[model samples]
Target chain A: MEQNLQTNEEIEMQLWEYIDGSCPINDMQRISILIERNTLWKQKYDELSALHTSFSTNVELEQPSMRFTANVMDAVAATHVAPATKKYINKSIIRGIAAVFFVMLTAIFGYALFSVHPTTGTTSMLPKLDTSKFNLSHVINSETIMIIVAINIVIGLVFLDSILRRKKEQQAVKP
Target chain B: MELDDTAVIQMVLQGQQAAYATLVTRYQQYVFTLVMRYVNNREQAEELAQDVFVKAYRYLADFKGNSKFSTWLYTIVNSTCLSHLRKRKDETILLEEEKMVSISDSNQAERPSDKMEQRTQKQMLENALKHLPESEAQALTLFYQGEQSVEEIGVIMGMTTSNVKVKLFRARQKMKDILQSRFSRELNL
Candidate 1:
């Protein structure tokens, strides 16, 4: 009885594939023979066939209001026009700038290393550093503080702008 | 001959913005139906469908013509609907409510007996469709109404062709099961 039930389920699945027109041709022929010879198979096939026909005929497509296209067009008109030219960020330009910066940094380091002639008497090529002389008060002047504050404010504004733009893009992408 | 979507896109890019209206009108019904599957609210679905078109227009310049225009538009529709579904995670519309509303609407219209029967059958099928899992419903709808082949449905749904076939098969079986039980209950009553 268990074996028969398993076989029936397999046959039912195959019959569905056949109904959907997704079965292989050989399998389709096999199911056709089964349907023709077996009353149970024939009954199931008939019922499924009727249901499939109803699905094809009865499921109606929902229509939007008459103003749907017009509303979409108006929304498009209010937005920025898509550029005809490529608007994507050019990676090549960015890579080129990065390459130049790297090369310049390497060249500067190479120069500093080559200029450090240990053999040239007692004058060290490295700059003398005195931590005690470097006072935080000197660096914390009004003008310098203002400059640092201005830079932070500019960076913060740019960061906030990018976050807002990304949120808008996300919203636009959602239905 | 009418211009193809590619040609229409080119025209739109070349400063003929009105050319886009043709595409919009051509696809509005299809977009609305697809979005309705997710939202289940006609007004919200219509709004989402319009949003799809507006986004499509805004991003038209990015289209590279690698795929069919309809495929590309359907991709946008799918993602948009999925994101909206994610946002309204707890707010799915009940299938029973949809059935009641549809039946009430049909009652308001003076239909012939045959037409009423047809409407009831259609409603039953729709309710059956709603009972399936979302992926199954989406797969069946895309296969039947979107007129997409299994391969195309796979591309749109981000699944393999075989997976799409399985989903379609399972969806149909589940719909059949639902209809059988529902009809049997009605008969008993």
Candidate 2:
């Protein structure tokens, strides 16, 4: 009795696969023979066949309103559809980052120039530090320093402007 | 000649945003129907479907094209509907375990003619689907209406193909069982 019940469920499952066209050709042929000869198999096959046909062909699908495509397109446009891609790289953010890096580099270079003192008489087995060819005045002049500072400030301001604009844009998108 | 989904995607990515209308039209019925199975309301389902398309557009670049576009689309549909369902689970839909199939009879063996049987089964199947768990109902719809293969369903539902097959089998079996029980009960009444 238990085996009969299992066989019914299993037969139904195989018929489901066979009707779905998921069964291999060999299994299809085998199941076809069983349906042709066996009354139990034929009865189950008839019932499942109808259900499968109805599911695939006769089942009524829900249709959207006429404005579905238009509404979806409008929503797509209104939303910020651009993904986080390199193509949308912000120039202002790049400039800001460059300014910050330049400021750090200039500070380090200036500090190194000051740190190198004139080690004159304290010479050992190690070669004495040669400060003769160094042109400190030319490299660290007031005008050049001021120019670098000005460029840094301009880039920093542009970066700041972009960030503020982005914040406003984010706020606008929130609602 | 009509452009395929990949070509349409490339066009959209290249700044011709209007090209997305093609994909939207192609998949609107599918997306709308799948979401309707979850929300079960026309207005909310339409709204959810619209949001899904927009979300898909936003992340269109993430689609690698290695898989069928429909399979990828279903993944998005599943997530969108699941999240929305989570919010309304308490009020609207029952939990999976709570959805059960109760068969009242197993001995009635009278069968109808082929044509009439098909029609009756169609009606019975539609009614029986309402009594099933959402996963099974969806599996049936995806297999029948969406014409999705069990393998593709596995990818979408994050299950193995065998597991998906079991779900499909159980779903069909339960629907048939529900109809039989209904038939037996009506005869008794």
Candidate 3:
């Protein structure tokens, strides 16, 4: 009997379903009976209902800033920049391949002109044939070719150096 | 009229990229309104709301329609606002500290007392909202201001209907307590 009463008077029964108009007819009757029989419950219901109405009606909802809509639209535009923007990797790889092609052309030009000269060095490319009196050393020492390869090595070193420097910088800046 | 939120969202997912503008126009007000409640600052709320909508557009494909469109949108807005609050520097206030100061002096100075009272009420309400736990505040505000039902609030909050009502009840009770405390002196009845 006590458990049944406790279950019937659960928190949900206090007022929410009644206020929400969600209580079924049977539950509503039970609540009505509770309200009629219990002064405290009736008073609490009146107070909560009034408070809900007061707060809901009296509170002024601040409209979002005037620029809100514009800003969101701008953001949407920015995200879809080209709608179907091409894949970045394809563009980057194409650029990389072009760079390699240019370097290879320069390497071949140097090999033909300087490696065949009757002077300086050995060709890294042709390790087998040595009959021509070409100065492979000239090509080997070819300042332009050396400069290009040296630049590539320097770039690689610079990139690695920057990465290490960045790591050290991050460590130094940590609290 | 702009495309409906669901339509634009669907179009954007289908790679009809321009459809995003329609969605933005359709729901920016609603999103901003939720964000404003959370952040309580116009500029910051707008910025945060914008960021949330942009994120939603990016992830529109993942939005399964388990809830109404507006409810789902607000869920995203609420999450963004909560994150914004987390990143803020203000100390949280308890719900018990709400005070209703008289705006009569301000009205006598220039404006009408009604306007001043309205402004005062707005400030008091905002303060009261800030004091509640984030979920309780969100649930109540969405329920009252957005006119959302228990089931709808439940969907937006990702809670059961009973849970949403519990939070709403607690939130309302807290707000009432605060209001009563603040106005007890001025109000006779």
| Count of backbone clashes, every candidate in sequence | 0, 0, 5
Please list all clashing residue pairs in model 2, or write none if there are none.
Answer: none
Please give, for residues A1-175, the per-residue lDDT of candidate 3 as tens digits. 9986665346435576787787798888887887888886687677767766766786566566666666676667677532323433478888999999999999888776666536655554555566686767756667878799989999999999867755653343232
lDDT tens readout by residue for model 3, B10-62:
77777787677666666666676677656656787777878887877766765
**Better-scoring candidate (lDDT), 1 or 2:** 2
lDDT of 3 at B85: 66
lDDT of 2 by residue, A1-175 (tens): 9999999999998998888888999999999999999999999999888666656775556799999999999888876556645557888899999999999999977766665555744423334666787869977999999999999999999999867755643343231
Output the better candidate (1/2) by TM-score: 2
* CA lDDT scores, all candidates in order: 0.76, 0.78, 0.66
What DockQ values do the models have?
Answer: 0.23, 0.20, 0.15
TM-score of predicted structure 3: 0.56
Point out where model 3 deviates above 4 Å.
A1-13, A36-39, A81-175, B1-4, B11-19, B85-124, B185-189
When summed lDDT is taken over every stretch of 10 residues in candidate 2 chain B, the lowest stretch is B101-110
Instruction: Show the lowest summed lDDT stretch of 10 residues, model 3 chain A.
Output: A80-89
**Every model: iRMSD:** 7.9, 11.1, 12.9
lDDT of 1 by residue, B36-152 (tens): 777778989988999899889988887777567887788899999888887877776445456546544544453333333444676767766766666777787787777776766
Which window of 10 residues has the lowest lDDT sum in candidate 2 chain A? A166-175
Q: How do the candidates rank by lDDT, highest first?
A: 2, 1, 3
